[model samples]
Target: MDPTIRNAKLQDIEFVLSGIREIFKIENDIFVYSEKKKLARNAIRDKHIRVAMRGDKPIGFSWFKIGDLTPFGLDYGKWSRKYCWISFVYVLKNYRNKGIGSLLYEDIMRICKRKKVKQIMLDVFTVNKKSARFHERIGFKPLLSIFTMRAR
Candidate 1:
C-alpha cells in the first residue's frame, strides 16, 4: 500500500497514456488502439486525471469528466442530477488483484463528492464478466441493456 495517488498534469500525459496502453494490451489485446493522446489533449486536459504510483512507476490510472448522461449501467431517468463519468480506468496487469483498483476508485469517489456530483457512471463491455463483477462489487449495479443490430 505504498502507492501514491494524485492528480495528473500535462507533463504526465505520456506516462498516463503508456500505462493505459499496457492495461489495454493485457486486458483487451487491442494493441493498435490509442486515442488517449487526443482525448487527453481535448477536454480532460484541463480537468483532473488521477494516477497511482508505486515509487516512481505508475501502476494504474483513472480519468473522469463531469457530465449529465448516465452510462450503460445506470438509469438516467431515475436520477436527474449531474454525474461524473469515468472515461477510462485501468490497472496494469501485473498490479491487478492487489487492491489498487479499489484504492483508485475510492479516491475518485472522494473527488466526486468534493465536486458535489450526484452520481458516478461508467460502462463495461457486456461480455467482460470479470469487469462487471468488479463494478458490481463497487456498488455499480446494471441499469440498461444496449442492443446493437447487425445488418445482414
Candidate 2:
C-alpha cells in the first residue's frame, strides 16, 4: 500500500521522540527526554517534520530544515548559499525495504527542490554501514568525516 505523507501533529510527539532515541541510542536521561520533547514539539508545530503512515500507523518520518552547512551535512562539492538539512529520518525496523523510507525521502527532496535548495544534506555515523549504504543508493555523497577527540 502507498504511504500517506503529511505534516506531523502534536499526537506524533511520542513516536517522533522514540524514533530519535532509538536512532541515536543515547542515554535516556531526564535532560535527554526533555530536550527531545522540546525539539519534537517545535518541529511538529513548525511543520518541519513529516510522517509516512501506512494504514493509520506511522511507518517512518523525516525532519528537515534549510540552513547553512553543518558538520553533519554534505558540502555539495561547491559553494551554495543554502542547503536542505535533514535532521533525522527513521523507519520502523519491521518496515525495512518496503519503500516507505524512499517515499519520505522523495517528499523531502521535492520540497527542497521547490524551494530551490542547492543540496540536501544528512549524516550517519561511520559505523552505521546500513545507513551509509542506503544513503548512497539514494544519491548522497560523502563530503567529509567528523572525528571526536576526548580531552580527558
Candidate 3:
C-alpha cells in the first residue's frame, strides 16, 4: 500500500514533531523540546511541512524552507537561484525502507519545481549514514561537508 502525502496543518504539529524527534533520538542528536516547538510553529506558519500518512496516522514528515546563500558559504555567483533547504526528513523506524521517504521527497521536488528553485539541499550528520545514502539514492549530489569539534 502507498502512503498518502499532504501539507501539514497547524493541528498536525505535534505528530510532525514526534516523527522528527524519533529520528533525532536515533541519531543521538540533542534537541531542545522548546526549540522544536518553535520550529514546528514556524514550519506550519510558512506551510513548509509535509506529512506522509498511513491511514490516519503520520508515518513520516519533511520540514523544508527557502534558504539564502551566505558569502562565507557557497559561491552564490555560481548558482542561478536560491535553494530549497530540506531541514529535516524523518520516517518512522517501523515504516522505513518502504519508499515512504521517497514519496515525501517527491512532494518537495514538486514544490521546488513550481517555485523555480534551481537547487535543493540538505545536511545529514555524519553519524546518520543511512540518511546520507538515502539522499544520494534520490539524486541529491554532495555539495558541502561540515564538521564539528567538541571542546575537550
Candidate 4:
C-alpha cells in the first residue's frame, strides 16, 4: 500500500509514542517507559516529527532538528547558518523492508533542504545492523563509534 506521509498532529502524540515504544521493545528486552516516554514526548512535540501511516495506523515515524552544520547531511558547511539532526526513525517490524522508512527520511531531508541546513547527524546503535545499513544506504558515513568504559 502507498503509505500516507505527513506531519504529526497533536492527537497523534499518544499513538506515535506508543508505536515507538513498541518498536524499541523488539530490541530492548527490558524496555523502560519513563525514558521512552520522555524521548517520545519531546520528539512528538518537535516541529520536525514526520509520521507515516497506513490509513489510521501509524507504521513509521522520524524526528529531526535543524541546528549546527555537520558532515553527514546535505551541503557540508555550505549552510553553516543551519544544520539538521535526525533523532529517531522507527518503522514497525511488520512494515520492515518497505520504503516507508526511506520515505520518512526523504521527508526529513526535504525539510532540511528547505531550511538551508548544511548538514545532519544521527547515532544508530552499533548492534542495530538494519538501521546502520539503512543510514549508510541513505548516504550517512560512519565517523566514530560511541563507547563507554566501565571500570569493573
C-alpha lDDT of candidate 2 relative to the true structure: 0.83
In order, candidate lDDTs are: 0.77, 0.83, 0.83, 0.75
**Cα lDDT tens digits for candidate 3, 1-152:** 89888888888888887877777886788868889999899888888888888999888898988766643466544554688878889888899888998999898989888988888877777788898899889898877776778999
Q: Which residue runs of candidate 1 sit more than 4 Å off their true CA positions?
A: 19-35, 69-75
Minimum summed lDDT over a 10-residue window in model 4 is located at 71-80
**Candidate 3 runs further than 4 Å off:** 67-80
Model 4 lDDT vs. the true structure?
A: 0.75
- Residue-wise lDDT of candidate 2 within 1-152, one digit each (tens)? 68899999999889888888887773222438898899889888888999999888987899998866554454446645678878788898899898888899899988988888887877778767888899999899997787878799
Residue 151 of model 3 has an lDDT of 90
Task: Tell me the spans in candidate 4 whose CA falls farther than 4 Å from its real position.
Answer: 22-39, 69-81
Candidate 4 clashes between residue pairs 3 or more apart in a chain or in different chains = 67-83
C-alpha RMSD of each candidate structure in angstroms: 3.3, 3.1, 2.5, 4.4
Model 2 spans with C-alpha error above 4 angstroms: 26-31, 69-80, 149-152
The best-first sequence of candidates by lDDT reads 2, 3, 1, 4
Model 3 residue 132 CA deviation in Å? 0.9
Query: Number of backbone collisions per candidate, in order?
Result: 0, 0, 0, 1
Which is the better candidate, 2 or 4, if ranked by TM-score? 2
Residue 60 miss distance in model 3 (angstroms): 0.8
Query: Which stretch of 10 consecutive residues in model 2 shows the poorest summed lDDT?
Result: 71-80
